[model samples]
Target: MARPTFRELTAQALSSVEHGYDLLAPKFDHTPYRTPDRVLNATVRVLRPYGPFGTGLDLCCGTGAGARVLRAVCRKRMTGLDFSAGMLDRARSAAPDGTWVRGNALALPFAPGSFDLVVSFGAHGHFLPRERPRLFAAVRTALRPGGRFAFPLAAPARPGTPAYWSLLAFDTAMRVRNAVWRPPFVMYYRTWPLTDVRRELRAAGFGVTLHPLSELGVRPDGSPRCRLVLATRLPEHSG
Candidate 1:
């Protein structure tokens, strides 16, 4: 069968929330918006050195993109969690071998130290900056002592590029949508800056490190275009 056109995919991705993804669910695997296999491979490569983990959790595991990665890195079991039922349904179908739980990232249903490793992909934009502390805390509680939470962060778009303008416009529109609409969608591409994220991670008890995803290549300024943030929880301080 032929691939769905970009127009069809965009129409589904941008239209009604559930219907949009419901339409895109099947072809989501074929889209570039899905984290590329190369990125996933690199994540596994970087995480393998730290792993041989018992259980892993994929936060906001949209369409099971990172769940597949977690399955490879995790030695025992993998679970994918997300808030959207539609997305979870698709992810469950795609990854029937893995566990799928539908829940908000803010209030993860897992107990403290339940997982040995936690990872997320392409979903941070769904969270606001203020929510990072709670989100990080939840993830921290979800992992065992010294367990790591990792994700890839792309370089900020250059100021003059179309990507930059598009992100600005999208954020503006989302702000407008939230102002006028009830139960906002709340996704913004520009809100989660890396510097702020690092501070938030530290505040939430993670000792963070950045590893360059060198295969993605560097920017014109000689900095990595994409890098992974690996945040490891420190051993709990006993009073």
Candidate 2:
């Protein structure tokens, strides 16, 4: 499918994030915003040793990209949750076998320990830094004792590189646009640094670890190009 036109993007941008996603739902898979299959596949590879999980929750499961990973790893059930009704509508169709729920990530509707694993992809930019605590805590709460919450994180673009400048410019534009606009769109490419995210996850009581995704290849510096953040909830009887 062709990308959303300039008019479509403009309209989406001017509206609230939920409504914007609602408008973009149909074309989301074709857009760069959708999580890539390679990223999803790499994450699945990284999570395999940790899983054979009983049930899984795909937090912010827009278009169900992460559902593929959950379906591959989870034994009992897979659920896709998102705040955008339209996105959930698409995800329901995309991953027909999975349960789809419409609700905010920060305010999960499910009971505590509802899932054995929780995974999210390509949705962090939608959340502000201040929201991480609530989001992480909610995910932690949603997991069963000793359950895992994991997501992929790539190294940030190096300074002075085209990718770096592009992200900087994009974030700057978003900040300016939000300052002048109402119902601000909250996406930012550079907001999720691994250090900050690890701190937030730790604060939320997750025993966090990083799994290097070798399948995704290595960086020029020999580091894995992407790493999966594996944050595990403590078992009830653990010290």
CA lDDT of every candidate: 0.85, 0.90
lDDT of 2: 0.90
Please tell me which predicted candidate would have the highest lDDT against the true structure. 2
Residue 92 Cα positional deviation in candidate 1, in Å, after optimal superposition: 1.8
Candidate 2 lDDT tens digits, 1-239: 78899999999999999999999999999898888889888888888888799999999998899988998899998998998999999998877899999998999999999999999998889999999999998998899989999999888888998999999999999999999999899999888899999988887888899988887888789998789999999764431
TM-score of each: 0.90, 0.96
Q: Mind sharing the TM-score for model 2?
A: 0.96
| Model 2 ranges with Cα > 4 A deviation | 236-239
Over all chains combined, what TM-score does candidate 1 have?
Answer: 0.90
Over 4 Å off in model 1, which ranges?
A: 1-23
lDDT tens digits by residue: candidate 1, 211-235: 9999899988899989999999987
